[model samples]
Target: MRIILIGFMGVGKTVVGKSLAKNLSIKFIDMDNEIEKRENKIISDIFKESGEEYFRKLENDLLKELVKQDNIIISTGGGIITKQENIDILKQERKVVFLDANVWTIQKNVSKEINKRPLLKQSENIAETIDNLLKKRINKYNDTYNIKIDINDKNINEVVSEILVHIG
Candidate 1:
């Protein structure tokens, strides 16, 4: 089985995806980490050097590659759905899960690691930025995921359990 987790940044997609993969005894792949590994640079550096358009193209290509494999859980970058190609790919998957979290939850979750995120670094006000981005992407997220899991105020295990129930 291939499980894909999608959401805005700081929504615990990576955390929940790892736990879900472990519970199901499958390999877990974080798309950002994979892209960094392949590019030989951190995502922020990729953004700085090559720009976001370059990074999104890489992301779309990687998503195409990853979807062909089996028994893996893919935790995608927050903005992966921004591309029409990516949304089309995600819509074809059976277990694409949208892990939804509110603006306050996202801000609190990502406060410590703001430097690691390229998009957040560009924001003058993180909360407002998050809100605006979420507003733009929420409809795409709704259209792409077959299942939606609310991650607000939930532990990783709780989220994983909820995902298991939905995917089982």
Candidate 2:
């Protein structure tokens, strides 16, 4: 069973995914980390050097390759659902869960560590960018996910339990 978690950055996909994978005894893979390893560059560096379009293409390709694996819990990049083809490919192979958290929750979690995210570099208008990006992709996220999980105010254990219930 391949379980894919998709959501905006700082929604705890990686943190929750790691816990869920350990509980389920499955391999955990973060797509962004995989891309960085493959390119031998950090994601921020890749976006800076090659442009977002190029980085997105790399992400799309990696997504395609990752769906072929078994018993894996994959945490996808926030913008992975921007492309319809990527959504289609993920749905074909695995059950996708959207980790639904409000924009404020996301902003609060990510604000201190904005530099880690290549997409949120500008300090002055970070909130605006996050809002715009979330707005633009929410429809795709809604359409693509098999299960929608609201993680606001929820602890990791609760989120993992919710996911396991949905999967069953």
Candidate 3:
């Protein structure tokens, strides 16, 4: 079985996916890392040099390739759900889990990170941007996911346990 974790930037997809995959004895793949390896460039560089449209196309292609793998836990980028084709491919081939977290939780988590997120870098009002983006993507997330886990105040183990329970 393939499991795909989808959510905003700071929602712990990578952390939780790694733990979950370890526990389940499945291979774990971070889509962003996969993209970086494939393109031989950082995501920020891709956005800066090639633009978001190009990045999105590359993300879509990566998603297609990822869904074809078996017994893998895949953590997707924040903007992956924006494309209907990506959503369709994920829903058709994997157990899609939406890692839901509030704006404050996301902000706190990301604030400590050194890596730059393209969307958050452009925003002066980070909270507002997060809120608006979450609102806009909520329905798409809802439609594509088989399970939605509330990630607020939850540790990686708790989140992984909840996902395993839901998937079973």
- Whole-model Cα lDDT of every candidate shown, in order: 0.95, 0.90, 0.90
Candidate 2 wrongly placed segments (more than 4 Å): none
- Those runs of model 3 whose alpha carbons end farther than 4 Å from true positions after fitting are none
Supply every candidate's count of residue pairs whose N, Cα or C atoms clash at under 3 angstroms: 0, 0, 0
Q: Judge candidate 3 at residue 67 and give its lDDT.
A: 84
- Clash pairs detected, candidate 3: none
Give per-model TM-scores.
0.98, 0.95, 0.95
Better of 2 and 3 by lDDT: 2
- Which of candidates 1 and 3 reaches a greater TM-score? 1
Best-fitting candidate, measured by lDDT?
Answer: 1
Candidate 1 residue lDDT tens string, 57-164 = 999999999999999999999999899999999988999999999999999999999999998898899999999999999999999999999989999989999999
